[model samples]
Target: MQPHQIVSREEWIAARKTHLDREKEFTKARDRLSEERRALPWVKVGKAYLFDGPAGKATLADLFWGRSQLVVQHFMFAPDWTEGCKSCSFWADGFERMVPHLAARDTTLVAVSRAPLAKLDAFRARMGWTFDWYSSAANDFNHDYAVSFTPDEIKSGGKIYNFGTSGFGVEEAPGISVFYRDEEGNVFHTYSCFARGLDMMNAAYHYLDLTPLGRHEQGLPYPMDWLRLRDQYQPAPGKGACGGS
Candidate 1:
C-alpha cells in the first residue's frame, strides 16, 4: 500500500463530508431496521423463569419491577466463573446513567448473568456499578437465549451454536432481550438481538473511530484491553504525554 500522508484542511473537510454522507445512509438504514424489528410479532413467554434478586427470588414477570417493559442484557458471567467477561462488563458500565431514562420511558433495564447472586454482586461492587443485576443460575434462560451453554453441551464440545437447524453454537454471546407486560399481567417477548446489534451502547468504539488509530485491531472486539477496578488509566506514554501538563 502507498504510504499515508496528511491532507490539507480543505481536503480534510471535503473528505469528511463524503464520509458523513455515507454514514447518514447507514444511520437511516439502521433506523429502518429498528422500526421493522419493533413491528415484528410478539412471542408470548408463558414459561416461568427464575432470577435471584437483591431481596430474594424473582420471576420473569418480576423483572419488569412494576414497569410495563423490561430490557435484560445477558451479561457473560457463568455461575462457576470467577469474574464477568471483559467486553460484557464494558457494556454493563454504560447502564448506570441509562437506567433513569429507561425508567422514565416505563422500561426497566437490567443485566442478567448465569453467575450466582453473591458472585455477581461481588463483581458489580468491584466495578463500582449500580445498575440492577440478577442471577439466573438455576434456570435455562441463558441457554434458551443462546448466552450460556448446558453442562452436557459443553462436555460434548459443540455448545457454540447459533439459532438455526445446523445447531447454533456461540461462546458467551452478548444479547439484549426486550419484554412487554399486558394489562392482564402476562409477559410477552418483544425483541432479542445479539452481537453487533448491541454496538451502539459501546461508547469506547464510537470515540475511537474519531481518532487517528481508529480501533486498529482487526479481530479484537474493542481497541482497549480489559480494565481492572484498581487500574488507573493513563494515556499511552508518548510525545503528547507532557504536552498539556
Candidate 2:
C-alpha cells in the first residue's frame, strides 16, 4: 500500500468533510442519471428468442416468470468451453444473491449464455450457483444482443459490440440487457450496457474501491488476469498472510 499522509484529528475531519461534499454531489448526479435511464425510449422486441434450459425450451417472455421486468446477464460461455469465463463467474457470484431482492421488486434476473444447456448446468452446479441460467445455443439471442461474434466477423475485424463503438474480436463478451413486459405480454428491449458500464452492478468491486489496494492489478496482463474460478482459488491464509489467487 502506498503511504498516506498522517494528519491530526482536526485536519482529518476537515479533509474528510471536503471529500464528503464531493461524494454527495456525485450521489445526486448518479440519481439523476438513473432517472434518465429509466425514462429512455424502448424498442419492441421482434424476435421470439427461445432459450434452452433444464426444463426445456423457454421464450424470452417465459423467462420473466410473471414479472413485468427482466434483467439478463449475457454471460460469456461458448458452446465448446468446459467452464465459464472466470471474470463472468465473478459477476455471477454476486448476482446470485440478488435474485430474491430483485424479484421482490417485480424484476427477474437471469443469466444467458451460448453454451449448451447441459454444459451451463454442469458449470453452474460446480460453482454452486442457483440463479436462473439458460442456454442460447439453439437461437441467435447472443448474436442479436451483440455479445457473441461470428468467426467471420472476427476474421474481418468486426465492430459490432457496444453498439459498434468497439472492435472486440473475442467469440463472446459480457453485457447486461433489460427488458420490460407489458400487460399485453409484449416484451420491449429497455436498455443494455456493456464493458465497464457493468462495474456498478458488482458489489465486490465497489467494496474494493474503498480499499487501499483497490483491486491491485497494477502490472497484470489484464484487469482480471489474477481472477480464478471460485473453486479454483487457493485457500485463504491464517491471520494476515495474503493468499487466494
Candidate 3:
C-alpha cells in the first residue's frame, strides 16, 4: 500500500469523470469481444468420454442433467492429491450460488476433475459445495481438454497447456469448457478458455480491481500465493490477545 493522494473535491471529481469515460469505452470494447467470442465455430465432440459421478459412471452428455448447454469447470484435482488447488477452490466457492441462475438459462454448470469420485465428494463435503462434481479418471477428458498434463510430459517440460508448448507450474491447470447439446442427442464443444481467460468467473477479483490495491499479487512467488480455500485463512496478526494489530 502507498500513501493516499489527498486532493480537493473539485480536482477529485474531475479526475474521476475522466477515468469514468475510459471505463465506459473499455466496457464497450469488452462487449464487442464477447460478441466475437460467441460467434466462434463449434466443433463436434466425437469422443465418448465417460466420468464417474455420485450416481455412477456417466457419459459427458449425461452430465448435462437434461440441459441443452453445459459448462464444465476443469477443477485441478489429481487422483492422488489430497486436496484441490486453492486457487481453483477460490473459483469453485463462487459456483454453488449460481446454479439456479444457470438453470433458468437452460444451462448446467458442473466441475470435472481427474480425482476419484470419493475424493471429490469428500472435498466437496468439506467445502460445503452443492454443485455437481464428477471424476474424469476413467477417460482422457482432461488430457483432451489440455487441463491435465501427463507425468512424462511434466518431467520433460514439453507439455502444452492453454494451447501452447510453454509449460505450466503444475501438471493440472484450471479451465472452463462449454458444450451445447442438440435435440437429437448430439453434443458440440462450443468454447474453452484457460489461463487469465478465466478472470470473468471470479467476481471477487473484478471487485478488487476497482479498489486501490487491484489484486496486489505483484512480487509474490505465484500470482495466487495469497489465496487459500475459504476455511484456511488465518486470523490477522495482533487480532488475538496479543498487541500485534
TM for every model, in the order presented, reads 0.84, 0.95, 0.93
Clashing pairs in 1: 160-169, 160-170, 161-168, 161-169, 161-170, 162-168, 162-169
Winner by lDDT between candidate 3 and candidate 1: 3
Q: Candidate 1 on 131-197: residue-level lDDT in tens? A: 8899998888988877776656656666354453233344466788899998899999898876667
Q: Which of the numbered candidates is closest to the native, going by highest lDDT?
A: 2
Tens digits of per-residue lDDT for model 2 on 1-245?
Answer: 78899989999999999999999999999999999999999999999878897678899999999999999999999998989999899999998888999999999999999999888989999999999899999899999988999888888876778998888878999999999999999999999999999999999999999988998988999889889998886555553324434
Please report how far candidate 3 places residue 120 from its true position, in Å.
0.4
- Stretches off by above 4 angstroms in model 2 are 236-245
RMSD of each: 3.7, 2.3, 2.8
Note the clash tally of each candidate.
7, 0, 0
For candidate 3, give the lDDT of residue 180: 96
